[model samples]
Target: MRRPHRVAVLLVDPVVGFDAAIAPTLFGAAEADGEPLYEVVTCSATGGQVASTNGFALVPQAGPEALDDADTVIVPGTRNAAVRRDGRLDDAVGAAVARIPATARTVSICTGAFVLAAAGLLDGRRATTHWRHADALRALHPAVDVDENVLFVDGGDILTSAGLAAGIDLCLHIIRRDHGGQVANAVARFCVVPPWREGSQAQFIEAPLPHDDSASTAATREWACAHLQEPLTIEQLAAHAGMSTRTFIRRFREETGQPPGVWMRSRRLDRARELLEARTLSIDEVARRSGLGSGANLRHHLRRGLGMSPTSYRKAFADREFTDA
Candidate 1:
C-alpha cells in the first residue's frame, strides 16, 4: 500500500480566511479508491491558538512541530505587516519553517510569498504574489523574479499564488499535478470554479468599458468566436470591428494580455479540445474544424500549449461520461 500524501498548512498570525481554507477543502475532499488521498492538517507557530484577519480565533491540533513530518507545507496570506514591509519573519516562525524537511515542497498563498522570500527559499526562482504587492515583493527580493501576472507560479517544488480567489486556481493546479485532469475536473465541478487557467495569466484583468458608450472590442470578440472554424487574420478582425489593424491589435492586447496570433492559437486549441472530448474525431477532422489547417498543426500547437497529445488528453479527461455514447 502506498502512503497517503501528507499536507500541512501553516496558519500564521492574522491569517487570511480565504487562503487558509483552500488547502483543506481541496486536498481533504479529494479521494483515491475508497480512502482520502491526503492527510491534511493545519498548524500554527505556537501550539495553542491563532487569530484570523477576520477577527475570529481558531486552534490547531498541531504546532510547527507537525511540519517535521509533512510532505508539503503551505503558508497562507497574513495581515501581519512585518512580513510585508521588511520581509521579516518572527524568529520562531523562521525556525519552524526551516525545520520543514529540505525535500518537502513549499507553497505560499498570496502575501505568503513574502514569508517564503524572507526565508530565502524563493531566491532566484520565478514567483508571484498578490498583484498589489508584486512590485514591493520584487523590490525587496531582487533575487526573485516576480511575475505579477498569472494566478499562480508553479516552481515544481515551490509554488505561490496571487491574492484571493487565485489561491483556488493554485490549489486546483496542484491537484492536477498530483493526480490528473480527470480528478482535477471533478474537483472543479464540485467547487464551482473553472478547472484550469494558464498559470501565466494576469491577476486582475480590466474588461472593456461598458457597452452603452463606445465601440469596444466585445463585438469583434463575438465575431471571432462565431467564425473560429475559419482562419482569421488580425486585419480581418480589425475590419470587422471597424478599426485599423494596428489599433485593433493594440486594443486586443490591452483587453487580452496576449497577442492576436497567440490568442487565436489558444482559441483553436480550445475548439480542438472540445471536439476531442465530445466526439471521436480524427486528428485531421479536429484540426480542420478548429481552423488549425492540418493535423500536424494541431499536434504542434496542442503539444506546445497543453503538453499532451489530443488522444491522451481525451483518455485522461474526456473518456468518462462521453464514453457512454
Candidate 2:
C-alpha cells in the first residue's frame, strides 16, 4: 500500500492560535478508504512549547527536523519579531524552512507569508497575507507579488492565504487537489462545510444578512446547482429569486464573489470534472449533463479552466472503472 502523505505544520512563536489549528483540523480530517490520507505532525522551531496569542502555549509533537521528510510543510501565522518587526526570519526558523525538500509543497497561513517572504521563498512569486499586513509585506519584500483581495493564492508548490477562516478554504482546496472531488466532498460533508469555494472568491463581501433565514439568493444558488445540466440564464435565475435582473446580478456577485454567468460556468465545469472522475460517462454525456452543449464545447471550457483535455483529466483523477485498465 502506498504510504500516507506526510504533512508538517511549523508553529512559530507568538502564533495566531486560530491559524495554528486549521491544518491539523482540516488535513487531519481528510480520509480515503476509511483511513487518514495524511499523517499530520505539528512542529516548532525547537521541538518544544511555543508561545501563542492570548497567553497560550503549544507543545509540538516534533521540531523543525520534521520538515526533512514531510511531503508538505505549513507555516501558520505568527507575530514573531523576526519576521514581523525586522522583516527577516530568525536563524532557527530560516534554517528549519531551508530543510524542507525542494519536492515538498509549502503553505503559509495569514502572516506566515512574512516568514516565507523573509526566507526568500516568495521572491518573484504571487502570494498574499492578512489584508492588514499587505502593505507591510510589499514594503518589506518588494520582490514578492502580493494580492490582498482573494482568499488564497495557489502558487503551484507554494500556497498562501489571507487571515483566519481563509485557511479553511485553502486546506479544502489542497484536499481537492490531492484526492479529487468525491473524496474532498466527503471530507467537507463530514466537517459540515461547503465543498467548494473557488480561490478567486473575495476575502471580504460587503452585504450581510441578519440571519441565514433572511431572504437571499442562497436558495436560488442551490436550485441552480441542481439544474446545471439545463440551460440557465441570469433572467431566469433572477425571476426564480423574485428579484429584478439588475438586482439579481448585483446580489449574486456580492453573495458568491462571482458574476451570475461566471458562477454558472464554474458550476458546470465543476460538475463536468466530478462526472469525469466518478462516472463512466462519455465526454459527450459529461458535456451534456454539465450543460456545456456538446463534447466540443466541454473540451473548450475544460481546456480553458483546467488546462487539460477530458481524457487527460480522467487519466489523472478518475476511478479505475472510469479509466481503462
Candidate 3:
C-alpha cells in the first residue's frame, strides 16, 4: 500500500491556537479506503512547548527535523516579533524552515504568511493573511503581492489563507487537488464543514444584515441554485426575492460575501465539475446541464479556473470511488 502523505505543521512562538489546529483537524479527517490519507505531525523550532496567542501552550510532536521528511509544510499564524514586524526570521525559526525539503509544498494560515515572506519563500508570489493585517504585511514585505479581499491564494506550490476559518477552505482545496472532489467532499462531511468555498470568495468582515429579520435572500439563493441550468437574470432573482434589483444585489452580497453574477458563475463552474467527475456525459452535455452554454464556454472557464480541460478533469477523477464512513 502507498504510504500516507506526510504533513509537518510548524508552530512558531505565540501561535494562534486556532490556526495551529486547523491542519490537523482537516487533514486528519481525510481518508481513502478506510485509511488515513495524511500523516500530520505538529512541530516547533525546538520540539518544546510553544506559547499560544490563546493564553496557552502547545507541545509539539517533533522539532525541525520533521520538516526534512514532510511532503508538505504548514506554518500556522504566529506573533513572532521579528518575522511579523521586520520581515525577518530569527535564527531558530530560519534554521527550522531551512530543513523543509526542497520539493515540499509550503502553506500558511492567517498571519503565517509573514513567516513565509520573512524566509523569502513568498517573494514575487501573491499571498494573503488576515485582512486586518494586510497593510502591515505589504509594508513589511514589499516583494510579496498581498491580496486581502480573497479567502486564500493558491500559488501552485505555496498556498496562503486569509484568517481563521479560511484555513479550512485551503486545506479542503489541497485535499481536492491531491485526491479528488469525492475524497475532499467526504472529508468535509466527516468534519461537518462546507464541502467547498471558492478560494476567490471575499473575506467577509463586518458584513451587515437587512434591518427586517424577514428580509433575507436565502430562499432566492436556493431557488437560483436549483435553476442554474437556466439563464438566471438579476431581475428574475430580484422578483423572486420580492425586492428591487439593487436591493437584491445588496442583500445577496451581504449574505454571501459576493455579487450575484460572481456567485452564479462559481456555482455553475462547480456544477460543471461535479458533472465531469461523476458522469460519462459529453462535454457539450455537461456544459449545457451546468449552465455554461457550450463545450467551448465550458472549456474556457475550466481552463481559466482549474488550468485543465473537461476531459482532463474527468479522467483525473473518473476512477476515484472512495467514500467516507
Candidate 1 lDDT by residue in tens digits, 1-325: 5567889999888788888998888888777555677789999988778888887886877999999999999999987677777787888788778888988999999998998999999999999999888899998899999998878988889999998888888988887767665566777888888676667766655455545424566688767867888878888999988888988888777666677787777767767876776557898999999998898988888888778887777676544433222
**After superposing candidate 3, which stretches have Cα over 4 Å from the reference?**
211-213, 318-325
Superposed on all Cα atoms, model 3 deviates from the true structure by an RMSD in Å of 2.7
Q: Estimate each model's TM-score.
A: 0.76, 0.93, 0.91
Deviation of model 2 at 44, angstroms: 0.2
* Residue 111 C-alpha lDDT in model 3: 97
* Candidates 1 and 3, the one with greater lDDT: 3
Q: What is the lDDT for 73 in model 1?
A: 96
Ranking by lDDT: 3, 2, 1
Selected candidate, larger lDDT, 2 vs 3: 3
- Per-candidate count of clashing residue pairs (backbone under 3 Å): 2, 0, 0
| Residue pairs in clash, model 3 | none
lDDT of 2: 0.88
* Residue 6 in candidate 3, Cα distance off native in Å: 1.2
Q: When superposed on Cα atoms, how far off is each prediction in RMSD?
A: 5.0, 2.5, 2.7
